[model samples]
Target: MGESDATIVSMILAGDPRGLNRFLSRYGHMLAEYIRALTGDDNDLFSAVYEDVLVDILKQLRVLAGTHETPEIKKLSGKGELLRPIFESAARTVRRRFPDLLKASEEPKASPLPVDDLAAFANSIDHVDFKTLLEGLAGPERELLVLRYRLGFDYAEISNIIREARVQLEERLVNARHHFRARLFASQQKAMV
Candidate 1:
């Protein structure tokens, strides 16, 4: 919905491969981070799933192409309905490709976070401040958090990706926040003691 995203979407619809690459570059770190949260240090699984997700996104590029002849979809609002389905489908592909990674691993070691707009994501790792707490959450809970926070997605888009009710997803996020806060406070108390 931001100006940059709108421009990038337009570029992609215009058949600008460079624009599509830039678009992906912008969200690439978040995507990698999201997957790392899911797969932990399972680099093999992460790489495979990540590639699959990208491939899926690339294929969906045609959808954004807005018809090879007319291409009016490029002129719409950047946050068009078309983008939602593309991202949702990509996330589902990732989930399908690697279902149990989060549950069966130690902390995920993500690929090098993309340098694109490093300033934007510089604090992402710290701002979230709940990575450890996330380890205890179920895979779906972790996935939702990654999508919402890391990927900058709203609940409706997240619902599309995970196929869950908005209310249920919101409740899960709230619970995860509370759980992490409690743990942080407990750790602080122990340190003070």
Candidate 2:
């Protein structure tokens, strides 16, 4: 956690209104990206989910800050422990309300690239190819990548949020990366024709 994060957490704990604003400013983009990745750019769903997440986070601020105790909140430390719980809570709420959004894994089809190509493609990824390839990924893979890279979450934190074992999460992430790289390689190959 940085000094700004500590200060924001402290302000929220102290019941300052500006704290919520600051918190929203800090995390709003990440939250937006998370919701979009999950819901596939459905603006209506995104807006509703965003509002719901904000409200939920605000309601639980005191508990998360450790001013009030709950089983979930009890595990939090005072420094910067509030963010994960808040994000996880919002994710769960969104998932519950939009179960259909989680069906990304049901898509049929596999990458054409063989296993040997994965490492090379991953190493050669450039920004343009990365975005194009990322969009081609299944929803779960995209979500996993976004959470790990964009959100700066470790495997442990991701496991906690996604409710999977750390080892399983790591395996899934590895596979997702392979799938993304393979897709990028295939696209590039096609463009050369």
Against the true structure, candidate 2 reaches a TM-score of 0.73
Query: Residue by residue across 94-154, what tens digits does model 2's lDDT show?
Result: 6777666666664334547656766665555453455556766777788898899888999
Query: Residue 105: error of model 2 in Å?
Result: 3.9
Compute the lDDT for candidate 1: 0.64
For model 1, state the Cα shift of residue 148 in Å: 2.8
- Give the Å shift of residue 135 in candidate 2: 3.3
| Residue lDDT tens for model 1, 8-46 | 666776777877677666666766887777776678978
The candidate that achieves the highest TM-score relative to the unseen native structure: 2
Pairs clashing within candidate 1 = 40-108, 40-109, 41-108
The lDDT per prediction is 0.64, 0.71
